[model samples]
Target: MNLLFLTFTFPLIGWLLLSFSRGKWSENLSALIGVGSVGLSALTTAFLIYQFNVNPPEGGVYTQVLWQWMSVDGFAPSFTLYLDGLSLTMLGVVTGVGFLIHLFASWYMRGEDGYSRFFSYTNLFITSMLFLVLGDNLLFLYFGWEGVGLCSYLLIGFYYSNRNNGNAALKAFIVTRIGDVFMAIGLFLLFQHLGTLNIQELMVLAPQKLVAGDTWLWWATLMLLGGAVGKSAQLPLQTWLADAMAGPTPVSALIHAATMVTAGVYLIARTHGLFLLTPEILELVGIVGAVTLVLAGFAALVQTDIKRILAYSTMSQIGYMFLALGVGAWDAAIFHLMTHAFFKALLFLASGAVIVACHHEQNIFKMGGLWKKLPLAYASFIVGGAALAALPFVTAGFYSKDEILWEAFASGHTGLLYAGLVGAFMTSLYTFRLIFIAFHGEAKTEAHAGHGISHWLPLGVLIVLSTFIGALISPPLAGVLPESFGHAGGEAKHSLELSSGLIAIAGIALAAVLFLGKRRFVSAVANSGPGKLLSAWWFAAWGFDWLYDKIFVQPYLLITRLLGNDPINSSIGLIPRLVRLGNSLMSRTETGNLRWYSASVAGGAVLLLALLLILN
Candidate 1:
């Protein structure tokens, strides 16, 4: 417990130091402190994992309370930390991959003007992300949730010198706020019904205490899902994440891939018991996840910017995890989440290295045939691509992603299973397509030729990890979950050896044909009638973003315009107009001398008395 406190404390300390010493410290020292604090946290997490493994706590969950945070009537929300297999997995990923991204940023952000400021924001991000995963209660989770949101806004707009970056940050904040609103409502509903925000308590109480299939349960689950969708960048709320590429690469890697975005997945898994009460809502979750996956995959295909492609890819991958969660494969969802952090972070960092080497050029068309120049980057990118493509047997992505597909299939949601499979093929194609076009084709432009050793070292570490981590979860991470939840064995069936392996091979084959074999043929098709449809499919992300823009953004903009011009501005002006009119009327009344005023008053009284006598 002490160590857990220290893990969060160090990052806060780093934030404080960097904030106070802003402009006082050298860039190198500031970067070290910022990254070093996260590194320390990562070490602490390692220790926690070890301790938990050795003790093997009953129900595989550990809860520690710091103090009573809030209590009213019978409801209580505590300041606490919950450690379990699920949370430990998230902690390892956040701190481990996050630390690497920070280190990479130290080099990638070198010589930048806001270097110290960047590190400060990074430290703050780490602290908030830790709080998010570590928090034992919903209110505390909300705190961490908003903390990450704030940090994202600050860091996304880190280059506030650019108006565009500032706008991007604003967009991100506004979009996620929509989801946060729903989540807050859901939290309120939970506390009202269950009388506690402690996750462990809620999980225990939900199965027996709360009435299953109630309308309120459905509403609560849906509201929570809405928040998750927004935070995870799924479907309608996903536009902000693509635009969030306006941030620096390392920031994108951390927020989009490793930490902030995954909060939604954690939320769902943490409250799995709540979701289980509403089967319809669970199906809705699966559908949303599937649709998001396919839509975002298409978006990735059309994007020309290196980071935007990865941004959309992150959305797509997260959709897969959500789908797993929707089908009651909570453990599988988390397993994918863990593997995803390694490969996705690797891809982003490698791309950052490429961008830095190319003098900040991000257009892949401007890039080609640099495999020899940056072999390390090339290798790292391939490793990540392999994982993303889910090439059979070898990559960590295969283990997790295949498990998701298998679970979806066995869960008896045929439509969702089909969509997920299609998404797998699309994922395979676009991922390697990026790799082939950027690294394998002829050199399109002359840029900075190669990366420094620092670039390759981190990439190497991630590659090694991505290659091996899948085996840890491959046998099945959830043998105990069903027993703990009192569910029947084999409720969710998966075939690791046969069905998953075949689908993975099919995905790889499709990618190879489209990207590697007959490349010109593929390009020609993209130019032809059917190819145009495919390209268009990719461009509009099958119109998901456009649909959302029309439904939400356009109407909001129109309302804003009307309010700005007529209601808000006119009302403000009316106050002054009324004041001026009162002054004008008073000026008329204030005319003249005291004798004239007395005479007027006497005449009025005499007339009133005369009228009264006539009436009588």
Candidate 2:
């Protein structure tokens, strides 16, 4: 009945309706339900935002306890909803932009055999992500976390008949589970120390209750970071996201770019109180995030598959968000998360348009001069790509990314700032590299012959949003926190303000020269020493996956074989051989049937008689 309840319930209702009517509902009706549900939820979120502005909650925190969900010995985990500026931002992104993506997907996935199924998964993903951001307690957050993971696996493997899709889904789920194990342990430790999973209560009590620099606290924080790293696709755990491109492009737009992948950054931001108490862990997070950002950016550069490049870019961009969080730029990180959801989703969906128009061809080399055939997609791609490259003032990427880099610089983490800069330069190179190679060059293949009004419409909508959303968030986000939290301030400084703007321009210019202006020269260089290395660096993602394969996968397989064959079989075989030998020795006594039986019986009687005589 409450607005928050409506915010959570409507999409679920749509999910149920579509699920029940999967066989009966027409594709158009199904699409409407799928998109409409999230749209209504977004509307509800807008209403809540308005209501919150009219009467802000105490200390910017809002709580609505629905019920006591469960209780154990001296422990209670309640089912409750929380609304704060943080949650409000996430709600808008998840439900609002999510609504737009769903609308796009309706057209994108129109004639697919699993139309209703895809929408069902999308709705479920939205519900889970909403619950994740809005939940008042850690238990429910974990519930939502697992829910999204399940949904990701399902959606990623949507085309289950394909072996590669199934494998990618499995890899994603399994790899993330490794991080979840650490997260679960961390959660238990938190409960043990604090005796509650309520996030607000934790925030209030954690600083006082937790001893600063405590080893156990550091361990717990690090463990939690592992989960965040996996969910957000940071180092060592980032491979799954790049591989997840095997899924449908819309799925990539929703999960990788917009909703699911950001969960890690959200978790760290939500638990800032806890992380702030553990500086060592925070530094570790920053270092890991920096490494991942640079690494993934390079990976994105050489990827020929349109979706794979975007996938790596998503990982790399999330690394920036993590870097912000790691360096105490919590608000900045979340701000990036919001802005990223807009433009990255736009990018992925636009790329999907290209793929669709190209008759499902994804190789950038196979595409050229598509700007004329799909002008809307080209515009959206450019907008998204510019934002990704963090081109100067007013772009969504510029505002959010510049804020992150500024925070990193101010945080006194010079190494992180440098890595971020390098990543920025590379981001521009690869983004425009794709743009030039795919859209600007001479037609490499026949123009995709099919044109539909439905296709271009979504691209146009996303392009408008990508270009404008950055400015809307700047003022409010700058003022979201109090001075005591160390965030009160002068206007948030953009890294690309003036000097930084020139630096950004230089990077863009370099990309233009290499990828667009001097393609033949660049191509020749790509075949040369340093350029070959750079290309290879991008192609193999600096051999991170190969190193992992050698160090972890091969060793694991070897151990598996050893355990399965040698040690286990040898142990089992020893017992079986001993049993066989004993049987063989005993079988000799049973030879010749009746004669042997009589001799044995007589021998036993004589022995018993002799013993009795001796005792007497």
Candidate 3:
């Protein structure tokens, strides 16, 4: 079975069919195609996994090239798929979580206009992301990378009639493009020095050609990191995600779960060799992850919009994955990435159900006492929240999150460890903050339920995975990741685990006190001066939007406004006009009359004679 070809082809075929559906595809059939494409791909991935286990790679890598994609100047890149432990792991996550999200979307988008269009974008994203992970070359991966971005813009701006939704999608597209620029530069540099963009060859040659701490190596990895930070919504590029909440809830789930947002982690992990040469940038990765998580946690706390709250949460959890990578815990990060996909998708889908029940009211502050009414959503949210908060040993998130902290501490970054603990606390605090206010207390308004097997089944599957997959998957992950990549140091500590567990409990207790009961305190604090300041800062994603406005936006706008009439260009453009004038004068000599031509020739000869006589 050509699993790689089939895996991506299924989704691409689905997207192509729906793109030209032209109202021929009914809502039900459109949903079937969208979900079925990914379902087929997921089955293929499982079969590949089974085959790989039965006949492991002799050299720990398996690659197949369907054909040569391009060849120029001795630079050849093939249409190839590379499968290893890493790509296989990502395949499972993308296809599995992706199918579940599509399943939920079928129910969530029922009767809505553009239902077919929504699934089209969803399948396209799946195809692009699959290409990203499975591609054998950097250019191919980059193609898939930008492909996902385009799909993200389309999906996030699906309701393009709304100004806010349009702007949010544009923001996401533009900000990530900034990082793409850096990544493109890095790719150029790599090709210049190493003469290849084939990912496996580049990995092998980069270390062979470039020494550790080489200047070019440092800059190249840093440039690549810029791209990763953008895609993953790490520090400095995270502002767009909160606003991305303006999209529908299914899009949010897809973004956070299986597609675009996770690409950065996959990129860094796939190119782990290049990163190893620049140790400083590697540590920087950890620092960025550690700090970003805390800031994102803080942002999550102040967000009234439920989707925005989850948006911030997604950023923070991805931070943990970054921290793991920085600490040389590659498997740990991927494990977290895997577990995160299941639970985060579950949380977002369940939240979608909540939004549906409330008739599209997104502000958790306006929702109350919905637990009994939306029992399935309530239960799913609880399961997802536990995983998000990493509730002790029971949840999948605990295993992944704990490994990162242990590695951070053992690796001698105690400060990062402490910061991670604080982030964990805030994660719990905000998660329950939404849960208590939205699902508890007096009813704010009537919320009609949207019932379906489609809705509940996906939630149930994800809930089970989030609850048990962590513990089950943890032991085997050590073997799945190749020995060459990396491993975290030191033995696991019961004390450290206990301390982290206690912190999570403390956060839950604090949230219950602060937000449970009357919840008037929530408002009172916000209305206070200090609270107002914190709320404002967090609401604005720590003023990154404002800071970028002052630093980049305002200046660009000023320049464009001053140049609106384009005077400088007009002046430069005058050279062409002057040339035209000179042409007109010259054309006078050839005025279609022999007498005029002769007279002009005589005049030129006389002028030349006069110049010669003066010189004499």
How does each model score on TM-score? 0.89, 0.89, 0.91
lDDT of 2: 0.82
* Per-residue lDDT over 1-616 for candidate 2, one digit per residue giving the tens place of the 0 to 100 score: 1578788788888888878875578898898888889889989988888877888777776788889988779787887998778888888888877887887788788789889888888898999998899898999999889989998999889999999999999989998888898899999888888888888788888888778887777888888998998888898788789888888888999987668999998898888878888988988888888999888887887889999998888988998988888788877788788888878988998888888888899999888888998777888888999888888875788877877787777767879988998888888888888988899777876655334555566566667667756547642333343211224334444323554556666777877787774478878888899988888877887787788889998999998977776876789799989999999999888777898799899999999999999999
lDDT of candidate 2 at residue 114, scale 0 to 100: 82
Q: Give the top-scoring candidate (TM-score).
A: 3
What would you estimate as the lDDT of candidate 3?
Answer: 0.88
lDDT of 3 by residue, 68-119 (tens): 9888989989879988888888888899889989998999999888999999
Q: Alpha carbon lDDT of residue 181, candidate 3?
A: 93
Clashes of each: 0, 0, 0
Lowest lDDT sum, 10 consecutive residues, model 3, at 482-491
**Weakest 10 consecutive residues, lDDT, candidate 2?**
480-489
Candidate closest to the true structure, highest lDDT: 3
Shift in Å, residue 172, candidate 2 = 1.0
